[model samples]
Target: MPYHEMDALHYVGPGWAVDDGFAAKVAAIVSSPGWVFDSFGYPQVRELLWEHADTVVWLDYSRSVIMPRVLRRSLRRTLLREPVFGGNRETLAGWFRRDHPAWWAWSQHAARRAAIHRLVHDPRFAHLRVIRFGAPEEADTWLYDLIHR
Candidate 1:
């Protein structure tokens, strides 16, 4: 499931916050035996989730490398009229919104990468295995190896 599924805005409209309710959900999932999530760096629940997770994967790609992918994805989602997180759909107008993933990705890429760099190095969470890929090919190779193994 997309990380947005845990967000209130995912169910509601165009606002976002990882509230106590969302934290509770994160706590539950993080305690489970086996699962994977893409939301590790969200500040509110990052500590709780990362503390328990065994492995973390970060795709530390450049904004130039990531933006086109984000935009293309948003375009595809809008054109397909696909229902995301709570039956909400992306739109051209929504693309202009600050919280839209495409916009957010472009706007926050640098800041987010820096934050992840700090978190990955933070000693409190050092017990967790961290795998970072700086290029698309590296990530693809890692995934291929994992799947083929």
Candidate 2:
């Protein structure tokens, strides 16, 4: 999305200390036109973003799908010392340490996916157009259609 547009994008995590600052930064950018905030994670902020976003693309993939992907990504990052959000890096020590976000997300995968399902189906989100993709191929096709249209 950023490649197609030079809009300010804010990524919100489950951490309030991180998300609060991020939300503030987003608010500042949104004051101007043509800026888009693309956040990942954080069901707590769903309503806030839903109100502003005309579209919501959900990759409602299974835990089996997401877990392996997250595991591989984390391991690769940890091994490569790749810089992630805010100049921080992932580490194997962090993954096994039990306090990492990846661990938390993996632990609460079922509950989190359920909550997202509820929120998206609830009448409160009726104003938002949701596109749910069950498979990676379908997701890519749908995204392609949207972009092309």
Candidate 3:
């Protein structure tokens, strides 16, 4: 769902989806049937999502694949001045900032990969079905197969 729509539905401030009480709000939202939630692995909501989720799809793309994509996306958004979540646009200066998406993804790549690796192998998550794809092509194939099946 779009961030603006989610914010309106959940009564959250713009760009506050990861703030305090977000997990509880998300938990409540995901309790309903036919809901699909996505996140960038916020630890606060991970357990709740894991407990309630039927299937987990992990896009385990490597840094080599992810870094270029992130850079390209940031460039496109900045150049186009596209309005993202909550009517916020990515500025060219933001690309050089430490909090930029490209920088964040690059910095967190190893830790994120480690966490996902642990989650996939941990016996605690055995009850949850996990589909991990190392490449974009693999993810596309999986989705195609799922839709066709």
Candidate 4:
């Protein structure tokens, strides 16, 4: 069963699948040798990625930074009818919908930052190199350094 507010399985792409309940397939993709997966949003999948990832690049900019990006993204998607994964398209209606998860997340920016802080300090992730970028220029510098290294 899929929520009407969300996209269905038909919108899946290569290396992307809807994991309604099955965890085994998810685990295999994350831990399988010589394989790299991306675009995980679910808490379970996120945890797996955090644990196995050798380096975590966190765009640690303030809400002042992220809010504008999200706004621009929503605007672009709405204007061009861009196809986000799972046949989802961003819309002003969705952005304003109180029932929508995006609205809730956008409003709870502080909570999200707090959670990320906890994740950074967690002993489980102590072995992970966390790159925190405070500004766009800093992020660009880190990327250049990473590529050259």
Q: Evaluated with TM-score, which candidate comes out highest?
A: 1
User: If the candidates were sorted by their TM-score against the true structure, best first, what order would they fall in?
Assistant: 1, 3, 2, 4
**Per-residue C-alpha lDDT of model 1 across residues 30-145, encoded as one tens digit per residue:** 77776677654467777887788778888889988989998888899999987666457888889879989987988898888888888789999889899989999999998899
**Tens digits of lDDT, candidate 4, 63-121:** 77777776777778888988786556666677677734446557777876777789889
Please give the lDDT score for candidate 4. Answer: 0.63
How high a TM-score does candidate 1 get?
A: 0.84
User: Given candidate 1, what's the lDDT at residue 73?
Assistant: 86
lDDT of each: 0.76, 0.64, 0.73, 0.63
- Per-residue lDDT of model 2, residues 1-149, tens digit only: 22211112232332212534655554444444443444443454456666666677777788778888888888889989986664567766787767575787688778867877887888877987887888888998877897999
Clash totals for all candidate models: 0, 0, 0, 0
What is the TM-score (0 to 1) of candidate 3?
A: 0.82
Q: List TM-score per model, in order.
A: 0.84, 0.75, 0.82, 0.73
Candidate 3 residue lDDT tens string, 23-62: 6677786676745666544677677767766778888898
Q: At residue 46, what lDDT does model 2 achieve?
A: 50
Instruction: List the lowest-lDDT window of 10 residues for candidate 1.
Output: 9-18
Error of 4 at 96 (Å): 1.8
